[model samples]
Target: MTTTAHAPLLETSRALITSLQEPGGAYPASPTFSAYRGYCWFRDGAFIADGVSSAGEVASPSAFLDWCAGVVEAHRTPIERVVAAAAGGAPVPQEQMLPTRFTMAGTPGADEWWDFQLDGYGTWLWAAAQHAARHGLDVTRWQPAAGLTVDYLLSSWDRPCYDWWEEHAEQVHVSTLGCIVAGLRAAADSGLVTGTRAEAARAGAEAAMAVIHERGVAGGHLTKWLGTDAVDASLAALIGPLGVIESESELAAATIAAIEDQLCTDDGVYRFRADTFYGGGRWPLLSCFLGLAHARAGNTARAGELLDWAAGTATTDGLLPEQVDGQLLAHEYRTEWIDRWGPVATPLLWSHAMVLRLAAELKEDA
Candidate 1:
């Protein structure tokens, strides 16, 4: 349970994340990867921001939050249109909706991508509220955009969009719903949202939770999607910092046990049983998520074990890769992706962010 040995790695992870962050406040998915090199995803950046904030780097996350606010504000009109369309049960074109990742300049990327995901917007609200509360700052600055985001979620929360892994856009993902619930609850509690907006958001969160309970559960654990029984590593976050599910709840325990049994290896955790991205290598971030869930459940010894395992996956230079090849389920497909997109992303900002997050959790327990 000792974190003394990994103290240096903790500092290194924080520094690496800070160094990779762009001056304009974007945290690139990876600096060298051809595919993710120039983009900043709200899902990734929110976690990264929360990590830095937890590590006592408040300004770093604050800047990122400001950038998010700007991006949301800039797209206010479009967001309203989409919300109105959804409310009226009219079809909204995917191209007209808000995008998932944006350029460093805070504009949507011109390049083609799976850009219909709503989880990131929700995640950003939750993370921003967490930051503001932790640092005793005014949440009002983010309220305008946050309100738009809430409206969007209120209208479209039940729609099928992309999941955290940016795949399966046609299915309603439980984890995606969890993110919306968490975000809505956070926004409602921020003291900035008022009147009908506040009431609607709170009711929306409760309705989302009811849906998750009725359809997202399978055999006591949260399923990957509403109709299926498969579990995903991302579900661990529901019981962790996201607080969609209580860390001590029976459902949370079952979900964690499922992840450990089905997706986790001695090296790290996989996205899912059928994942083939980057040869389905064990993901460093998911390991940190599982560690965080364990830490929240008061399993400090187990949590420390996961943190140590994640630290060991770092390269010799202390850079954490997005995923490791150990126990790769799709080993046959590794070379294909490498040839197509170059080597796997090293020093992935999200991976380092999760490392910092878990390390901070362990340190707090220490």
Candidate 2:
């Protein structure tokens, strides 16, 4: 799992990510994938930014963070309006809120999508802080947008919206809460906000964690959402990359074990047991996420196994797809999506980013 051992693919992933980063600093979800082409997600880009930053590439992630700040600043009016409305007891329609993805030019996408996800905003805050901290970069440049994001999240963190997969828009997802908590904590610690904003960031993060402790945990591990006992592959992220929950803690250990037991297989990890998207194929990114969690928990051997499985999913050309067809959960739905979107998204930036991320973790551990 050392970077030296996987230098070829790791180098290819790094080059591909940097090459695909839009001129505006936006990282397109995928360049050739039909549905994802021309779009960048704050959530995906933040994770990708962290990956790029982790690989010792500063300028790439810095520009992405700058782009994220610019995006929030550009829509300051709408973001404040939504926050004020929610504060006054009348939440605006979901459509009026900020979107989940945007054009590489930093504007909202022209086409409609499950666009109201809150995790991305929080994720941006987290990534910006992490990058600045990792490299000792100045953080003040992002403070204005960070303040706006903290206000927006503090106002509406409890509202139900889309999950990471853009599904179940009606349920408040636990993974989303983890992102918010980590972001808020980062903002509070980053010296990026001051006065009331910083105070609110600390309090908001604590409140979110309280909610998770009271309602998000079930059967000794984190649940998919507040009321459900179901686990999603995403919950593993809370332990490692996000660090909302400590990796060595009992809750983190149990959550990782639950995901491995119920959702993981020899191929990779499934999003959830009932997932049907892309025939519910194993995701290389999710496997890397679980591997990261394991690495943080001091389970290097298991982490290496997960990384190898994910690496095996790469094409001969070293491109990683959004997910693979191995041991699909709902093979029946595969053809329909292929006919609609044409083959799975190859060279998914997030997949390559996750591989870099896990490899970095293992390399450090080694």
lDDT of each: 0.88, 0.92
Best prediction by lDDT: 2
Backbone clashes under 3 angstroms, per model:
0, 0
What tens digits encode model 1's per-residue C-alpha lDDT throughout 194-239? 7899999999999999999999999899999998999999999888
Candidate 2 lDDT, tens digit per residue, 161-224?
9999999999999999999999999998997788888999999999999999999998999999
Model 1 whole-model lDDT (C-alpha atoms): 0.88
List candidate 2 stretches off by more than 4 Å: 1-3, 364-366
**TM-score for each prediction?**
0.97, 0.98
Check candidate 1 and list the clashing pairs. Answer: none
